[model samples]
Target: MQALTYLEEYHSFKEAALNSRFLKHKTIQQLIKKLPEAFEQRCIGQSHEGRDINLIQWGNGSIKVFLWSQMHGDEATGTMALFDLFNFLQLPQFQEISSLLAKSCTLYLLPMVNPDGAERFVRRNAQQIDINRDFNHQVSPEARLLKNTRAEINPHFGFNLHDQSTLWSVKKTGKPATLSYLAPAFDEALSVNEVRQNAMLVIAQMYKYLNPLLPQQIGLFDDEYEARAFGDNFQAAGTSTILIEAGGMFGDEEKQEIRKYFFLSILSGLYAISTRNYVEEPLQHYFSIPKNNKEIFHILIKNLLHQDIRVSIGLSYEEEPAEQGYATVKTYTIKDIGDLDHLGAYHIYKEETLQIEGPIDIYQPANFTLKKDNMILLSFKNGILQSKL
Candidate 1:
C-alpha cells in the first residue's frame, strides 16, 4: 500500500489504459468491474451508431458534483486523469475523502462521453456534431444525454474536462504545458455572477495545488459564450461549472506529467468543494511563473550562407508511422533575420529533391535551375528564405 510518485503512478496508469483491448464501450465495462463498489453503471442514451452511452456514479449526498471527460474522443488526456483520480479515491489514504464524498456530495462521472467518436479518435461524435457545441440545439444524442443527466441530478458544481494541443501556450511564456480553467459567463452580456465567482474560487484552489508541480504552466482560459457549450449551459442552469483544459507541457510529448498534475488538481478541487473552502486564495508564488508557448523549434541554425548574409533558420521534424516503418517530414521556417551587411545584396533560394532510396534531389528557387543531385537545402544570401521538404 505504498504511495507511488506522480511520474511512476501516471506512467503505470497510462500504459494500462492505452493497452486495453476494449474500445470505449468495453473500457467502461472493465472499469466497473475493477471498482464495482465505487462505480454503478447507468445508461445515458444511445449514440448515432447505436452505442449505449454510459455513466458511472459514485458517492450519494445532497451536494452533487458532475464531471465529464473526453467529450472530444481524440482528447484522451483528461479522460486518463479521471481514471487515475478514481483509483486514488479508492486508496486507503483517501478513505475520509471517499466517505465524505459519498455522504456529503454525489459525484457523477461520464468517462469518454463520446464513444462513437472515441473509437475513431475523432473530435466530433458519430453524427459529426461537436458535443460541446451541441448544448444549445441538443441535436446530437451525446449532447442530449448529458443535458438529461444534468437535469436529473441538478449538480451544484460541474467540471468540464478537456485537452488542448501543444501549439497553444500562455502569452510571452516558455512552459510547454499549461492547465487552464474558465468560469463560463452566464449570459451574452458576459457578466459575472455568484456562480461564476464560485467556479473561479474552485479553479483558483486547484491552481494552488497544481502550481508547485507545474509552476508557470497554469493559466486561465478565455471565457466566451457558446450557446451549445456544456460549461455555459451548466452555468446558465445556476450551477457553478469549471472548464478544465489540459494543455502542453515542456519535454512531455505524451503529456504524462501534465496528466499527473491534473489528477492532483481534481483531488484538491473536490476537497475544496466538500469543505466549502472556495475563498481560500492561492499562493502568490503561482503567479510568478510564465506561460507556455510554441517559440522553440527542434533544430535552429544561425548565420547560414557563409555567415555573410545572416539568417536564423528553424527546422521542425514530424515523425509519422509509414508502411515500412516511420517517415520523417522536415519543415523549415525563417525565425529571424541577422546582419544583412555581410551578403551585400543577395536573394534566398530553395532546393527540393525526392529520393526513395537515397537523399532527395535539390532545385533552385522557382524551380528555375537544378542545383544538386541529393539532399534538401536552402541558400539565403540576402533578406530571408523559408520552405519545407
Candidate 2:
C-alpha cells in the first residue's frame, strides 16, 4: 500500500534521462555515472559487440535479491523501471522504506544483460543467440556473465524481468495484459516445491498490491517449464525466482504508463521479501489470478464487407528498429479475419455506413482504406497506416 503512495509521485524520482523505450547501453552508462555514491557500480563483463555490461549493487542485509533485466534487448521497460527504482532508493524523504531495504536485503541489479541486442533494438544478441535460452549452452558472453554472476552471488531470490507482446490480454477481461507475473515451473512435471512456492507466495503478494492499482490489467504469465530459461533454472537451483513481464497498455505506445505499475510491482515484491510478509499470503491467491491469453488485437474493424460478406478484421503491427534503434517502424499486418466481436483491441472502428477502398486479406500486409461518405475512417498503404479520421 505504501508503494501506491510512492507511485503517485513517480515522476519525481523517475529517471528523466531514460524516457523512451529504445534504451541503449551508452544511455545507461551515463545514468550510472550520475548515481549517488550509495550504489556500487562496476563493469562486470562486455557484450559480443564489445559493449560494457555493468552491474550495480545496493542494500547490505543478508537477504540477497538479484534482479536482471533486458536479456531480450528490445524489452527495455524493465530496464527503465530499474533505473526509476535506483533513483527511488536514494531519495532522502523515503528513508523509512529505503533504510528498511538496506538493513534487510542486499540488491544486485544487472539492468541490461544484452547491450548488443539493445544497440540494434533486436531480441537476440549480436551472435544471433537468445541469451535467455542460451543457459545450457552458455555460448554467448552475456549468458555466461549472467549465469556466472548468479552462481557467485548465490542469491536468495531472483527477479527475471522482460517485456511481452502487446497482443497478450487477460483471459475473460479482453483487456491488454499491462503486467504479468509468473513463478516459473522448475521441472517438466510443473511441481511446486518450497522454492517455487515461495516465488508464488511472493507473486501473490505482488498481485494483491498491484491488481487494485491496475485492476483487470495484470495477468499471470504462462508457467510452462522452460528448460533453458533463467527463471526456471534459478528456481531449480534453490533461489526463489519471480518473473515480472511488462505487457501493453491501450494508449501507452511507449509503455510510459506501464512502467509505473512495473516499478510498483518490483517495489512491493521487495517490501514483501524484506518484511517476510509473503509467507502470510495464501497459495490460492496465486492460482486465483487470471491467466494471460491472446484475446486482443492492436486494431480491430467490425462489420466490414470483405468479398461481400460482413466480417471483423484484426490487425497487428511488427516493429522494426529505425533511426539507429532510436525509434521504430510499425508495419501493420492483417492478423485475423472473422467473428471477433468477443475480442478487444487498442483501436476499434465500427461505422454503420462504410466503404472498403482496397483489398482486405488475412496473413498479408494491410493495404486498404475505410471511408464513410467521403470521410476517410482509416487508410493503410503497404502495411503503413496513412491516416485515421
Clash counts for the predictions, in order: 7, 0
Model number with the top TM-score? 2
User: Distance from true position, residue 85, model 1, in Å?
Assistant: 1.8
- Tens-place lDDT per residue, model 2, 150-189, is 9999999999999999999999997999999999999999
Q: Give the range where candidate 2 is weakest over 10 consecutive residues by summed lDDT.
A: 1-10
Superposed model 1: Cα runs more than 4 Å off: 1-15, 19-23, 282-308, 313-389
Clashing pairs in 1: 169-292, 176-248, 176-249, 176-250, 177-248, 177-249, 353-361
Give candidate 1's whole-model lDDT. 0.64
Candidate 2 displacement at residue 57 in angstroms = 1.2
Which 10-residue window of candidate 1 scores lowest in summed lDDT? 361-370
Give the alpha-carbon lDDT of every model.
Answer: 0.64, 0.92
Q: RMSD for each model, in Å, please?
A: 8.0, 1.0
